[model samples]
Target: MRLIEGTYGIAVLHADFPDRIVVARNGSPVVLGIGEKEMFVASDIAALVAHTRQIVTLDDGEMATLKADDFRTYTTEGTRTTAEPTTVEWEAASYDMGGHDTYMHKEIHEQAEAVDRVLRGRIDDRFSTVHLGGLNLDAREARRIRRVKILGCGTSYHAGMIGAQMIEELARIPADAEPASEFRYRNAVVDPDTLYIAVSQSGETYDVLAAVQELKRKGARVLGVVNVVGSAIAREADGGIYVHAGPEVCVVSTKCFTNTTVAFALLALHLGRTRDLSVRDGRRIIEGLRRLPGQIAEIMEQEEEIKKLALEYAEARSMLFIGRVRGYPVAREASLKLKEVSYIHAEAYPASELKHGPLALIEPALPTVAIVPDDDLLEKNRAAMEEIKARSGRIVAVAHREQEKADHTVVVPKNEDELDPILLGIPLQLLAYHTALALGRDIDKPRNLAKSVTVE
Candidate 1:
């Protein structure tokens, strides 16, 4: 017998013998499936759903030995235990790889269901509360949280930005977002009273992992908002809520981004209801949360229109994206997606900063994608749109309401003020995907990028 231990979670499997093998999990996820005279194991549930849904989810500090006929469970301390197998009801069609033309398009369309999946079984209807068991913070502790600091990289960082906003608006918590890569370099102050959240789709992103490790080393509590189960960050963090976005096959993120933002909403609702947020307000947010999946579907129906619109701007030499507050992160993420899949040169800036520098670049030759959420910033976003129009720049507006100034308008379904960003992001995703398709660029494997960034 070998003892495998680490500061974070670890999954080890011994396959030296054919008939029997040892599997153990610390912080990461390991699911076992029982069949007739055969058993299967994997870190991701998606990989096993096709074969069997009768799964036993191994908790932290648990081990299992699989033989030809049966499996036995034990604790890390070597005590024999019993783990019941649960039959899960999941659609096998969701995991079918070859159904769509490209993984990017397939994952893009999966957002509605992906967002719905993350919200499943989480909301309490009677109390209008959200329960996130992984948060490990009770109402009393939650009420006392001094602040929230979120960390992530690339797409995850954009999601974290939205998360920071949700926490501030819904939970009334002081919150901010920083890039995990930069956070690790600065030796940032680690406060025990503040909740630190590390966001990563893979949960194995090196920068996010390093940031979590450093925060843990400093005795600061850390939580993970991650997609992949049992990933390094998921194991290392004290506790966390999984995004449960399933497998994101596209190098450029689509479903994961939307789902992560929804996860933040759930977390925010959990924190908000725990504090001073009234049940009336909580129910409003809860209803808004429930409306997201349908709203995403409504936005998706504009695919043909978005495809035609993409063709109109596919020839642009460069592009600009602008928004304010909640919309800024959506623009940033949209710009990244455009650059990644379409290989277009794109820049994103807060709408208020247009005159600061980016506004000068607006001209007939360049295009700007503007996010116009129907919030207090609506007037400011309109002013920015007029500014871009003054420079003869072609404008493509994503808004809850029609914008007369926009050269083209993609109207998205409206939600609560705080949830508008989540809805607005979907249209931009379709824009990016369709633009890449129009340009004949490799949608799945864009020029030099990997799905997960494991290195610095």
Candidate 2:
């Protein structure tokens, strides 16, 4: 009331009546009855229905300027006020690619441009070096670092596992990937020089947050690799890099996972250079990174084949995923994607570890998904396929080239082992997405789950 009078440069008054009160603003008055000291004011009748069945919506850009025994009046741009109300409306077009039929199909088609956007401006094409200005570690400090700890959950955790291998092999740095939930509870050593990197799509994951807080308490240098801007983890970390993959509405993440992996690969190569790793070797890896998006696009063209394979195995209640070495992490992610969306029971095992255990679970009713890239492990994975066949387990293989060894195969274009994960990951994601659709499961919001787990 005071603000209104002040703005209009007019004296306003209030008077008590038997069943109501008379209020005046800029010499115009409005009368409203009181019930338990509650007074309602709104811009529209719809907003006042709950408060009182009787209401009057003020006219646009007008103040309720007068109050009297039975009525009120309003006026626009009062004596001394110049403010005006403005209405704004916004609409967004659907990402749906007209009846190509599924979101997974549209997303699969978007991979090439998505990956390209994630890699843009961060690399120098002429020199093949990563430009991460926020990585504050100098050469001497990087060399002094003896251990690395990566913390995350779900798919991000699997990415961390793969990152551990890259860090160890390229930077020659001993690295460990810990499930953030477990890492927080376990007794661990951390110091000022120790580097702890946290990966999260939302940067507010409960377990990841807890682990980062614990590491900070122990005085470790913390870094965040996240997709969201100004998220909790990003604000808490000493320095960080944004994945810049944009908003991923799907509950099962697609582009963000590959983008995060690309960022980690770059970070690993950067650390390698800092620690005096061979320039020739680092450039070769960078060259592979540059070509990754196109390779993934080529692989994505096989979505129809992947969909057919998913349909073939849709009736199976249980599935097993197997991989060796770096592929083990890919296997873990594949299993997670399947279980998350399709509600199918799925498990991932290191192919080499099958003989020790997992082999006991294979049977005719279960389908096996193997990540069989054309590498040293191809024969080993084929051997595992043979075992699954011996047990009569239906086989669905994701390989670099088509193979007759399995009941079904979704082939990807071949690349080095390091780059194979990026190419091979797409079809598995598509498979899970389409399978979920076929089962009529919610693809964007799975039951009993939040996009980011923010509480411990």
275-344 per-residue lDDT for model 2 (tens digits) = 7667787778878887887788777777777777777788779888988887788889999998998899
Candidate 2 lDDT (Cα, whole model)?
0.72
In model 1, residue pairs whose N, Cα or C atoms come closer than 3 Å (at least 3 residues apart or on different chains), thus clashing, are 9-27, 28-230, 29-230
lDDT tens digits, residues 57-150, model 1? 6765678888768999998789999888877555467666667889899898888888889999999999998889988877888888999999
Best by TM-score: 1
The root-mean-square deviation over C-alpha atoms between each candidate and the true structure, in angstroms, is 4.5, 12.9
Clashes of each: 3, 6
Q: Tell me each candidate's TM-score.
A: 0.84, 0.77
Give the least accurate 10-residue stretch of model 2, judged by summed lDDT.
84-93
